[model samples]
Target: MHLENLITQKVKEAVEAIYDISLQSVELQPTRKEFEGDITVVVFPMLKLLKGNPAAIGNAVGEYLEREVKEVVAFNTIKGFLNLVISDTYYLNFFNGIRTDQSYGYVSGGQNEAIMVEYSSPNTNKPLHLGHIRNNLLGYSVAEILKAAGKKVYKTQIINDRGIHICKSMLAWKRFGKGETPESSGLKGDKLVGNYYVAFDRAYKDEMLELKSRGMSEEEAAREAPILKEAQELLRRWEAADPQVVALWNMMNGWVYDGFETTYKNLGVDFDRLYYESNTYLLGKDVVAEGLEKGIFYKKEDGSVWIDLTDEGLDEKIVLRSDGTAVYMTQDIGTAIQRVKDYPDITGMVYTVGNEQDYHFKVLFLILKKLGYSWAENLYHLSYGMVDLPSGKMKSREGTVVDADDLMEEMSETAGSIAAELGKLEGYTEAEKKELYHMIGMGALKYYILKVDPKKRILFNPEESVDFQGNTGPFIQYTYARIQSILRKADFDFNTNVLAEEIEGLQDKEKQLLKDLEAFPQLIQAAAAQYSPALIANYTYDLVKDFNSFYQQVPILAEPDTRLRNFRTQLSKKVGEVIASAVGLLGIQVPERM
Candidate 1:
C-alpha cells in the first residue's frame, strides 16, 4: 500500500482506540517542502467526533502514529496539519520492485469497453493547417493515454468529402485547368486541390465585384455570384449521382485523400477506421423523417425538419433543410449512429473538435438522448481552443492559413539551426542529422502544444518551443539521453534482481527522486481521468527536474562503494525508461543518444 493509505488506515484505528470514535476516513495532503515530512494527515476534520483543540489532536495522532507504525519515524504538527516523516525503506522497497520494469506506469489492456476517438475531420477541398495539427495531436495523445490507462481505444476520423466547398475546388480546377493533374504538375494532390479552392474564392470575389458594379447590393451580389451558382449546381448533380459528376467527384476526392494520407503519416497520426460524408450524408435524413412521424421533431411549412432547443437554452437547430436535403447536423447524427453500428463494442465516443462546436455537440448529445439511445450519455466533446501564431488567425479560402506541411518543415529547419549553433551534432552522417532534426522539431511542436490546457488558446512561437531549456520537449529528451550515457559508462552488473538493499544514510535527493518516480502510475490514472495531456506533460517535466537535482548532487559512476553505485545506476536507468514511456504516450520519440 502507499504510505498515505497505510497511514490513513492506522490513523483510523488510533482514533477508534483513543477517543472511542469510529472515523471512516482521513484527509491527507503532500507535506509542505519547508516542513520535514512525506505526508500530512489533517487534524481539522476530526473535531466532529473528538471535540478538542486541533493542535492537541494533531500531536496525539502524531504520537500514536510514531508509536504504532514502524514506517512513521518522526512527526511534527504545524497548526492543524500533522506531518509524518516516513522511513527511507518504504521508498527503497518501491524502487527495487519497479526498477527493471520498463512498463512500470502502464497497465495492461484487457476486458474493457473500447472507446472511439474522432479527430482531424478535415474538409476535402483544402490541405490541413495549424488548427488540424492541434486537433490531431490532442486526439492521438489522448487515445494513447487511454490505452495506457488500460482502455481499448479506436482512433478514427470522418472525411468531409462532399459539399459546396468541395465542389468549389472541383469547379475551379475544371474552369481554369487544361487537363492538369497531380502527376503532370508534380504537386501533392491535396495541395493541388487546395490551390483550386483558393482560386475559386478569388474568382468568386471578382464575380461579386462585377455584379455590384452593375448596381446590385453587396448581399445581392454575394447571393447571386455566377461561380457560386455553378458550384452549387455541381453539388446538386453530384448528390443526384449523375455519372460524370460522380466520376469527377471521386477522382478529385481521391487526390485529396492521397494528399491527406501523406500529411497524416508525416504528422504521425493514424485512424483505425475512416468515415466519408459522401456515403453518410443521407444517413440521418431517414432518421429525421422517423422523428417527425414520431413527433420527436416538428416539420415546418417549407418541409424542413428541426428540433426546438430554445427550452434547453439553445436556439432551434435544423436537421433537414427546406428542400428535403440533409444539413451538417443530419449527417453528424447519422454518422454517430453509424459508428455504433460499425463497432458494436464502442461504449463511448470522444469528438476532438474545436470549442466553436461546444454548443453543437451539447445539442447533438441531448437530441441523441431524447431519441432514446443508451450510449448518448457517453458522448464527450473534447473541445480545444484555437492555435494562433503571433501573426494572427488563419483563413483557408484566402490562402492565408498556416499549412501543416510548411509548419513541420519550418520546425525542422529551426531545430537544425539551433543544433548547429550549439554544436550538438558531432560525427553524425547527413541522413542521421536530418532525422534527428525532424525528431526534435516534431517533439518540440507536440510538447509545446500538449503542455497547455486544451481550453486555453495558444500563442505558438516555434523558436520558444524548440529551446533546450525550461519545460520544453528537447530539454526532457536531453536529460533522458544524459541518463542513457551514464548507463552506457557504468561497468557494474546492476541487474535489477540483485539490486542494493536499504543503504545506510541515503541522501535526501535520492529519496525525493524515488518519491517522484513512485507517483508515475498514479499520475497516468489522473491524466486519463481528466482527459488532459497537460497533466502527463507537466508531470514529466517535474520528474525530469527532480532527476536533474539528483544527478547534480549525487556521484554515480565515481562512487567507490559498489553497492551505492549499483543502486544509483539502476535508479537512473529506471528514470530514463519512464521518461521515454511518458513522452511516448504523447506520440513523441526520444533519441537514445543526443
Candidate 2:
C-alpha cells in the first residue's frame, strides 16, 4: 500500500486502541500549506466523545498516533485538527520503492474489461477542424487512461463517409470538369474533396436564385439541376454497388485515410479498428429486418422503419426512411449490433461523441436494451463539450471553423520562434529544432484541450502563445529538464546502498520534495477513477511547481556537504521521475526544454 494508506491505517488503529472506538473515516491529506505540517486529519468527530473540547481531543489523538505510528515523525493539535509530520524515513522508503520499479507510477494493460472508444467521426466532405482535435484528444486520453487502469482499450473511429454532403462533393467534382484526383490536385484528400463540396454549395445557391427569377417551379428547377442530378445519380450508383462508383469511392477514401493517418500520428492518437459508414449503413437493413421479426419495431405506411419507445419517454426513432434507404439512426443500430456480435464479451463500449448527440445515445441504448441485449447496459456515451474560439463558438456557417492542420502549423511555427528566442535550441541541428517545435506545439495543444473539463466548452485564446509560466505542459517539461541538469552535475553513484537512517542527514527541501513525490501513484489512480484528466493536469502542475520552488530555494550541488548534496540530488531525480510518469498519463510529450 502507498504511504497515505499506511499512515492513515496506523492512525486509525491508534484511535481505536486509545479511545476504544472504531475510527471509521479517518481522512489524512497533505497539508495545503507548509506551516500546517505534512498531513492533517480532523478530530472533531472524536471530540464529542471526549465530552467536548475539540482541541483537547485532537491533541490526545495527535500525541497518541505520533508515538505509535511509524509513518509519523511528530504531531500537534490546532483548531480541532491533528497535524502529523511525516518522518523523513517514510519519504525515503517511498522514494526507494519508486527507484526500484521503473514504471512505478503507471499501471497499464488493465484487466479484461474491454472498451471500444469511438472518436473523430468526421464527415468525409470536410477536413478535420479544431473541433475534431478536442474530440480526438479526449478519446485518445480516455483510452490511454483506461488501459493504464488495466482495461483492454479498443480505440476506434467511424468515418461519416456517405451522406448528402459526400454526394455534394461528388456532384461538384463531376460538373467542375477535367477529372482531378487528390494526386492531380496535389491536395490532401479531405481538402481536395472539401473544395468540391464548397463549389457545389456556391453553384447551388446561384442556380436557385436564377431559377426563382425565371419563375420556374421549385420542384422542376431542382430536378433539372445538373449538380443535383449528378449527385443523385452517383448516390444511386453507389447504393446499387456499381463497379466504377465503388472503385472511385475506395480510391478517394484511401487518400483521405492516408491524410488522416498523418494527422493522427502527429496528435499521438491511433485506433485499433475503424468502421466506415459505407459498410455499416448496409448492415442496418438487416438489423431493421431482425427488429421487425422480433416485434421490437413497427413500420410506417411509406415503407419506413422505426422503433417505438414512447413509454420509455424517448421519441420513436426512424431507422430507415421511405424508399428503403437508411438514415443516420439506421446505421448506428446496425453498427452497434454488429460490434456486439463481433465481440460478445466486450464488457463496455464508450462513445466519445459531442453533447449535441446526447439524446441520440440515450435513445440508442434504450433500444438496444429493449432488444433483449443485457450487455447494452454496459454501453456508455461520454458526451464532451464544444471547443469554442476566444471570439465565439465555432460555426461552420459563419466560416469560423479552425482547420486542424493550419492550427498545428501556426502552433509549431510559434514554438520554433519561442525556442529561438529562448536560445534553448542552440545545440540542436535544424532538423532537431523542427522536431522539437512540433513536439512542444502539439503537447501544448493537447494539454490545453485536455486540461479543461470535457463537459465545459473551452476558449482557446492562448493558442500558439500558451504560457509555460503556470499550469501548462511546458512547465512540467521544464521541471524534467531541471532534474536532468541536476543528474548531469551529480557525481555520486545512485546504485550505492543508502539506508533510511542516512536520509535523516538530508536537507529539509529534500525531505519535503520526496514526500510530495510519493503521491504520484495515488494521483494517477484518482485521475483514472474519476475519468477526469483535469485532475492529472492539476496534479502535474502542483508537483512541478512545488519541485521548482524547492529547487530554486535549495541548492542541489552547491552544498560542500557531500552526503547532504548526494541525498538531495537523489531526491530531485525521484521528483523528476514522478513528474515524467504523471505527465505521460495524459499522452503529452515533455520536451527537455521549454
Candidate 3:
C-alpha cells in the first residue's frame, strides 16, 4: 500500500480517538524542505467539523499518531500542519520489495477498452518537416505511455495522397522533367518530388505576374494562370480515373511512400495501420445521405450538404460541395467510422494534430455525436503547438520547411562533435562511436520536444538539448550511464535482497531517491490520464537528480560494510532500470556507457 494511504488511515484513527469526531478524509502533502519530515498532514480541514485552535488540534492528532503508528516515529506541529517522520526500516523494506521487479512502474494492459492514436498524416507531395517530427514523437510517446498505464493501443495515420497539392507536383514533373526519376537524379524520391512542387509554385507566380502586367486583375491572373489550370485539370482527370493520369499518380505517390518509410524508420516511429485519402475521400457520402433523411444535416439551396452547429456555438460547416464532392471534414468522418469498423475493440481515439485544427476537431466530434455514435464522447484532439527554429516559421510550398531527414543528420553530427570535445569515446571503435552519436542525438531531440507541455510552443536549439548538464536529455542519459558504471564495477552479485535490519539508517539523499522511486507507478497513471508526456519526462529528470546526489555523497563499491554496499548497489541498479523504462516511454534509447 502507498504510504499516503497508510498514514491517512492512521490519521483518521487518531482524530477519532482524540477529538471524538468521525473524520471523512485527510489532506497530505510532501513536507516542506525546511520541515524535517517525510510527509506532512494538513490539519486545517479538520477545523470544519471540530471547533478548536488549529495548532492545538494538530498537536493532539500528532501525539495520537506517534503513539499508535509504528511507521510514525516522530512528529512536529507547525501551526496547522502535522509533519511526521517515518522509520528508515519502512523505506528499506519498500526498496527490498521492488529491487528485483523489472516492471516496477508499468501496469499490465487490458485494464480498459483499446484506444486508436492517429498522427503524422502528412501529404504525399512533400517529405515530413519539423512540425511532423513533434506530431510523431507526441503520438508515439502517448501510445507508449498509455500502454504502460495498461490500455491497448493501435497506432495509425491517414496519408493525404490525393489532393490539389499532389496534382501540383505531378503536373510540374510532367511539364519540366526531361524524364528525370529519383534514381537518375540521385535524390530521395520525396525530395525529387518536392523540388517540382516548388517549381510549380515559382512558375505559377511568374505566369500570374505576367498576366497582371498585361492589364489583368490579380484575381483573374491567379485563376487563369496556365500552370494552375493544368494542375486543376490534372486533379479532375485523376479523379475521373483517366488511365494515363491515374497511372502517373500511382507511380509518383509510390515514390513518395518509399521515401516516407525511410524517414519514419530514421525518426524511430512506426504505425500499426495506414489510411489513404484516395480510398476514404468518398466514404462519408452515404452517411451524409442517411443524416439528411434523419434531419441531422440539411441540404442548402445550391445542393451542398451542411450541418448548422450555431446552437452549439459554432458556425455551419459544409460536408459536401454543390457538385456532390466530399470535403476534408467528410473524409475525416468516414475515416473515423471506418477505423472503428477495422478495430471494434477501440472505445476511444486521440487525434494528434496541430492547434490550427482545434476548431475542425471540435466540429468533427460534435457532428459524430449528433449522428448518434456513442464512441464520439470518448474522442480527444491532442492538439500541440508548432516547433519554431532559430531562423523562423517554415512554408512547404516554397520548399523552405526544415526536412526531417536533414535535421536528424544534423543532430547526429552535433552530438558527435560534443562527444569528441568531451573525449568520452576513448576506447570506442569508430562504428560504436557513430552509433552512440545517433543514439544520443535522437534522445536529445526527443526529450527536448517531449519535456514541454503539448500545448506550449517550442523554440528548439540542438546545441542546448545535447548539453551534458541541466534538464537536457543527455544529462539524464549520462546519469543513467554513471549508474551502469557503478553496477559494472561492483565485483559481487548485488541482486540478493538486503535484510531490513542490516542497514542502520537511511541517508537523506538515499531516502529522497526512494521517495522519488515510489512515485513512478502513480505518475504513469497520472501521465496517461492527462495525456501529458511532460509529466513522465520531468519526473524522470527529478529521479535522476536524486540518484546523482546520492551517488556523489554515498559510497557503493568503496563502502567497507558488505551489506550496506550491496544495498546501495541494488538501489543504483533499480534507479537505472526505471530511468531506462521511463525514457523508453518517450521513445529514447540510453547508452550503457557515456
Candidate 4:
C-alpha cells in the first residue's frame, strides 16, 4: 500500500482510539519546506467532529501516530497542521521495492475498459501545419499517458478527404498544370496539393475582384466566382460517382495519404484506425430519419430535420437538409456510432479538436445521449487552443501558415546550430550528429508544445525551446545523459538493492529524491485522470530539478564509503529511469549522451 493510505488508516485509528469517535476522512498534503516532515496532515477538518482546539487536537493525533506507526519516527505541530517525520527505513524500503521495476511508475493491467482517442483529422487538400502538430502531439501523449495509467487505448483519426476544399485543389491542379505530378514536380504530394489549394484561392479572389469591378456587389461577386462554381460542380460530380471525377479524387487523395504517412512517421504518431469523410458523409441520414420517427428530432415543413435544444441552453441544430443531405453534425453523429460499432469494446472516446469546435462537440455528445446510447456519457472533447508563432497567426489559403515539415526541419537546424556552438558533439560522426540533432529538435518541439495546458494558446519560439538550460527539453535530456555518464564511470555494480543497514543515514538530498520518486505513480494517475500532459511535463521538470540539486550537493562517484557510493548511484539511476518514463509519456525522447 502507499504511504498515504497507511498513514490515513493509522490517523483514523488514532482518532477513534483517542477521542472514541470515527473520523470520516483525512486531508493530507506535502509538508512545507520549513516543516521537517515527509507528509503533513490537516487537523482542522477533524475539529468539527472532535470538538477541541486545532493545535491541541493536532498534537494529540501527531503524538498518537508517532507512538503507533513504525514509519512515523517524529512529529511537529504548527497550529492545525500535524507534520509527521517518516523514517529513512520506510523510504529505503520503498526505493528497494521499486528499483528493479522497469516500468516503475506505470500501473499494469488495471482498467479493462478501452478508450479511443481521435486527433489529427486533417483535410486532404493541404499539408499539415503547426495546428495539426499540436493536435497530433496532444492526442498521442494523452493516449500514451492513459496507457501508462493502465487503460487500453486506441488512437484514431477521421481524415476529411472528400469536401469542396479537396475539389478546389483537384480543380486547380487540373486547370493550371501541364501534366505536373509529385514525381515530376520534385515536391511532396501533400505540398503539391497544398500549392494548388492556394492557387485556387488566388484565382477565386481575382475572379471575384473582376466581377465586382464589372458592377456586381461583393456578395454577388463571391457567389458568382467561376472557380468556386467549378469546385462546387466537381464536388457534385464526385458525389454522383462520375468516373472521371472519382478517378481524379482517388488519385489526388491517394497522393495526400502517402504524404501524410511520411509526415506521421516523422512526427512519431500513428493511428490504429483511419476514417474517411468520403465513406461516412451519408451515414447519419438513416439515423436522423429514425430520430424523427421517435420525436427525438423534428422535420420542418420544407423537409429539413432538426433537434431543438433551447431548454438545454443550446439553439436548435439541423441534422439533415431539405434535400435530404447530411450536414457535418449528422456525419459526426454517424461516425461516432460507427466507431463504437467498429470497436465494440470501446467504453469511451476522446475527440482532440480545437477550441473553435467546442460547441459542436458538446452538441454531438448531447445528441448521442438523447439517442439513448449507454456509452454516450463517456465521450470527451479534448479541445485545445490554437498554436501561433512569433511571426503571428497562420493562414493556409493565403499560403502563410507554418508548414509542419518546414517547422520540423527548422527545429533540427536550430538544434544543430546550438549543439555546434555548445561543442558537445566532438566525437560524434556526421551521421550520428544528424540523428542526435533531429532527436533533440523533435524533443524540444514536443515538450515545448506539451508543457503548456491544452486550453492555452502558444506563441512558439523555436530558438527558445532548444536552449540547453532552464526547464527545456534539452536541459532535462542533458541531466539524463549526465546520469548515464555517472553510471558508466562507476566500475562497481550498483544494480543490487542497498540494504537498509548497509547505508547508515540518508542525506536531505537523497531523501528529497526518494520523495519525488514516490510521487511518480500517483502523478501518472493524476495526469491521466485530468487528460493533461502538462502535468506530466511539469512533474518531470521538477523531478529533474531535484535530481540536479542532489547531484550538485551530494558526491556519488567521489564518495569514499562503498555502500553510500553504490546507494547514491542506484538512486541516480532510478531518477534517470523515472525521468525517461515521465518524458516518454509527453512524447519526448531523452538522449543517452548530450
Candidate 5:
C-alpha cells in the first residue's frame, strides 16, 4: 500500500484510542516544499469531535503515528497541518518493486462494459482537413487513454457517403472533364474528386448569376440553377437505385475511399468498424412507424414524421420528409440503434463531432432514451471547438481549406529546416535523418494539439509548435534522448536489479523524483475519467521537468559509492521507460538519439 493509505488507517485508530472518539474520514495532501515531510494530515476536521486545542490534537496524532506506524519516522505540526516525514527505505522499496516492470502504469485489460468512440466522420465530397485532424487526434488519443485505464474500447466512425453534396462532385467530374482518374491524373483520388467538387460550386455560381441577370430574384436564381437541378435529379436517381447512377456513385465513392485510407494511414488513426449513410438512411423508417403507433410521434397532412419535444425545451424535429425521404436525424437514429444491435455489450458511446452539432447530439440522446434504450443514459458528445489557422477559417467548397496531407508535409519540412540550422543530425545517414525529421514533426503536431483542452478553440501555428524547447513534444523527446545517452555512456550494467537493502542516503531530488513517479497509475485513471488527453500531456511535461532537475542536481555515473551509482542509474532508466509509455498513450514516438 501507498504511504498515505497506511497513514490514514493509523490516524483512524490513533484518534479512537487517544481521544476516545471514532473519526470517519481522514484528509491528506502533499506536504509543502518549504516543509520537510512527504505527507500532511489536516487536523482541523477533527475539531468538532475533540473540542480542544488544534496544536495539542496534532501533537497527540503525531506521537501516535511515530510510535505505531513504521512509515512515519518523524513529524512536525504547523497550526492545523501535521507534516510527517517518511523513511528513505520506504521510497527505496517502492522503486525496487516497480523498476523491472515495463508495463508499470498500464493495465492490460478491463472487465468494465465496452465503450465505442466515434471520430473522423468525414464527408465523401472532399478530402480531410484541419478540423478533421483535431477530431481524429482527440478521438484516437482518448481511446488509447481509456484502454490504458482498463476500459474496453472500440474505435469507429460513420461515413457520410450518400447525399446531394456527393452528387455535386459526381456531376462535376462527369461534365467538366473528358476523362480523368487518380491513376491517369497522377493525383490522390480524394484530391481529384475534391477538385471537381470545387468546380461544381463555380459552375453553379455562374448559372445563378446568369439567372439573376435575366431579372430573376436571387432566391429564385439559386433554386432554379440548372447545375443544382441536375445534382438534385442525380440524388433522386441514386435514391431510386437506378443502375447507371448507382454504378457511377460506387465508382466515385470507391476512389474517395481509397484516398481516405491513405490519409488515415498517414494520420495514424483507425476504426474497428465503419457505418455508411447509404446503408443506414432507411433504418429508422420502421422505427418511426413503430413510434407513431405507440403515440411517440405525429404525422403531418403532407406525410412527414416528426417528434414534438416542446415539453423537453426543444423544437419539433422532423425525422422523415413529406416525400418519404429520410433526413440526417432519421439516419442518425437508425445508426445508433444499429450499433447497439451489432455490439450488445456496448454500454455507452462517445460521438466526437464539432461543437456546431452539440444540440443535435443532445436531441439524439434524448430520443433514444424516450425510445426505451437504457444504454442511452451513458452516451456522451465529445464536442470540440473548430480549429483556425493564422489566416482564418477554412471553406472546403472554395478550396481554401488546409489539406491534411499538405499540412503534414509542411510540418515535416519545418522540422527538417530547424534541425538543419541546429546541425543536430551529424553522423546519421540521409534515410535515418529523414525518418527522424518526420517523427519529430509529427510528434510536435500531435502534442501541440492534444495538449489543449478539447472545448477550447485553437489558433494553430506550425512554426510555434515545432520548437525544441519549452512545453513542446520535441523538448520532452530530446530529454528522453539525453537519458538514453547517459545509459549508453555508462560502462557498468545499469540494467542490473536495484536492491532496496543496498540503497541509502537518499537526496531531496531523488525523493521528489520517486514521488512524481509514484503518481503515474493514478494519473492515467484520472485522465480517462475526464476524457482529456491534455491531462496526460501536461503530466508528462511535469515528469520530464522532475527528471531533468534530478539529473542536474544529483550524481549518477561519477559517484564514488557503487550502490548509490547503481540505484541512480536504475532510477533514470525507469523515468525514461515512463516517458516512452506516456508519449505512446498520445500516439507519439520518442527517439533514442536526437
Candidate 6:
C-alpha cells in the first residue's frame, strides 16, 4: 500500500547512510511525465551538504541511492534531479497484495474519528431540483469515501420546513376556495404547496401595485406581510399543540418528505440524523443572547442582535432582526451548538453546500471559534460549485429549474433508448431491459456529475455525458463488462508462483498495466486526503484505458503459451475487482452485463 511513500522511504534511508542530516526534510516527488521515470527526487536541496556543483551532487546521490536502496533498481542523474525507478519486481508486490488481499488499496485511515456531513437542506416549499441532486450525490459519495477511509461519518439533512416561505403556501391554501390536499388533488404535496406559493406571489404583487398607486407604500399593500405574520402565528400554534394548525402542517410536510425520500432512495443518499429547521431555528436564539451577555454580540436600539466580524475581515451578520427573529445564521449557530452538545466529541463537522455560501461559513466558523468551542477549527465547509446546463443557468422562479425526479426519469429513458439503439441486448425481456437501463442511466448521470472537480462548475451536456466512450462512468463500466466476458471465456486458474516470478514475461502493455495497478493505494489515499472523489474518478478511467490498450495488443485466453495466457487472464481478474470497488465508492453500480 502507498507505493510512492514506500519508494520515498527507501530513498530516504539510503540517503541517511550517505550523509548525516535529518532526512525528514528530504522530499521525494513523483515524476510528472512518463519519460522521467516513475518517481523523481530533487538533489538541489542536498547540494550544500555535498559541497559541490548541482550535477555532481545529483550524480553522487543517484549512484549511492541505486546501489544502497533495493527499492531503486535503477536511478540516474539529470541536472539536479535524482530520477528513481522502482524495479518491475515492486509492481509484482503491489499487484499481488491488491489481487490477493480482500481489502486491497484501502485503509481505515481516520481511526474512528467522527465527522458530520449535512447536505440537501432544501425548503419544503418546493420540489427537489437539479441543484439538490448535485448536493445529495456529492454528500452521499463523500460520506462513502470517508467511511471507506475509516471515519465514523454522520450524514444529516436539515429540512427547511418553516419561515415566511412556508407561510405563503398556508395563505394560498386558506384564501383559495377549495379545501384540497395533495391526496385529493393528485398533486405532490411539495408541488401543491409550491403552486400555492406561486399563487400567493402573483396575488401579492398585483395587490401591492394597486396599493402603491393609491398612496400606500409598495411594501404596505403586500398581504404576504400579513399572511406571513399569520403563518408564524400558525407555526407557534402548531408548536403549542394546536390541533388545527398541526393537522395542516403535518399534511403539507408529509408530501414534501415523501417526495424527498424517493429522491434520496433513487440517488442513494442516506442520513444517520435528520434535523428540522422549525425545531432548531429557535434553539440558537438563546445562544445568541448568551453571547450578547458575554460581550460576543451587541444589541441594537431596535432590539436586533448583530455580530461585528469586521476585525475578522468579515461584515457584521445579523443573528436576530430588530423584532428578535432568527435568520439562517442564528439557526445554524444553534444547530451547530446543539450538535456539539449532543455528540460532545465529534472530531469534525463537514457542511456540503454550494460555494455561494463561502462567506456565510467563514463568518459562522469565526463566530463559533470566538465562542470558545475548541472543535470549531474542525468545521469544514465543503463548498461545491454550481451545476449549469449546456443551455444556461437554471432559474427556479423562471421554471427553468430541473426537478430531481424529472432528471432521473429522463436519464432512465435515455438509457433505455440507447440500449435499444445499440442492439446490444438481443431477445432480452422487458424486465431485463429495464434493469440495464436503470444501471446505465444512473451510472451515466452520477459519473458525468462527479467526474469533474467538485469546486469546478460543470456544464452538463446530455449528448457528451451519456456517450459510451471517453472518461465517463459508463466507459469504466463498459470496460468491466469486457473483462467479465474475458474471464467467463478464459476460466484460467491463476498460479501465484508464475505471477510472482515472470514479471518481465509481461508485455510492454503488461508493464504499463502493472504501473497503473500500483497507483491504486496511492490513489485511494490521495482522494480521501484531499476529499476529492474526482481523483478516484480519474484513476478508474486511467486504469480502464490502460487495460483496454493492453487487451487489444495482447490476447488472454487466445495465447498459445499456457503460462503467459494464464498470467494475463489472472491480471485481468485483479483489475476487474479494483474497478468494481472504486466505482462502488462513487455510488455507481456496474451491471454485470452493461
Best by lDDT: 4
lDDT string, candidate 4, 461-551, tens digits:
9999999998788888999999999999999987777899777789999999999999999999999889999999999999899899999
- 1-594 per-residue lDDT for model 5 (tens digits): 767778999999999999889999999988999998989999999998888888889999999999998878999999999999988888888898899999998988776778899999999988999999999999999999989998889899999998998999999999986689999999898888899999999999999999999999999999999999999999999989999999999988899999999989887889999998888888888888888898888999999999988899998999889988788888888888899899888988989999999989988988888899999998999889888889999888898989999998898899989989999899989999988988898899999999999999999999888899889998989999999999998898766666767765689999988987888888899888888999999989988998898898898899888888888988998899999999898988999999
Clashing pairs in 4: none
Which has the better lDDT: candidate 2, or candidate 5?
Answer: 5
Q: Cα lDDT of all candidates, in order?
A: 0.90, 0.76, 0.92, 0.93, 0.90, 0.78
The reply for model 1, stretches above 4 Å from the true place, is 11-26, 42-52, 290-295, 300-302, 496-502
Task: For residues 23-78, write the lDDT of model 3, one tens digit per residue.
Answer: 99999988887989999999889889989999898888888888888888998999
Number of colliding residue pairs in each model: 0, 3, 0, 0, 0, 0
Score candidate 4 by TM-score against the native.
0.98
| 10 residues in a row with least lDDT, candidate 6 | 497-506
Which pairs of residues have clashing backbones in candidate 3?
Answer: none
Q: Give the candidate number with the greatest TM-score.
A: 4
lDDT of 1 by residue, 135-249 (tens): 9999999999988988889999999988899999999999997788899999889999999999999999999999999999999999999999999999889878899988988
* Residue 524 in candidate 5, Cα distance off native in Å: 0.9
Q: Model 5, residue 460: what's the lDDT?
A: 91
Cα displacement (Å) at residue 593, model 4 = 1.0
Candidate 6 yields a Cα-based lDDT of 0.78
Worst 10 residues of 4 by lDDT: 494-503
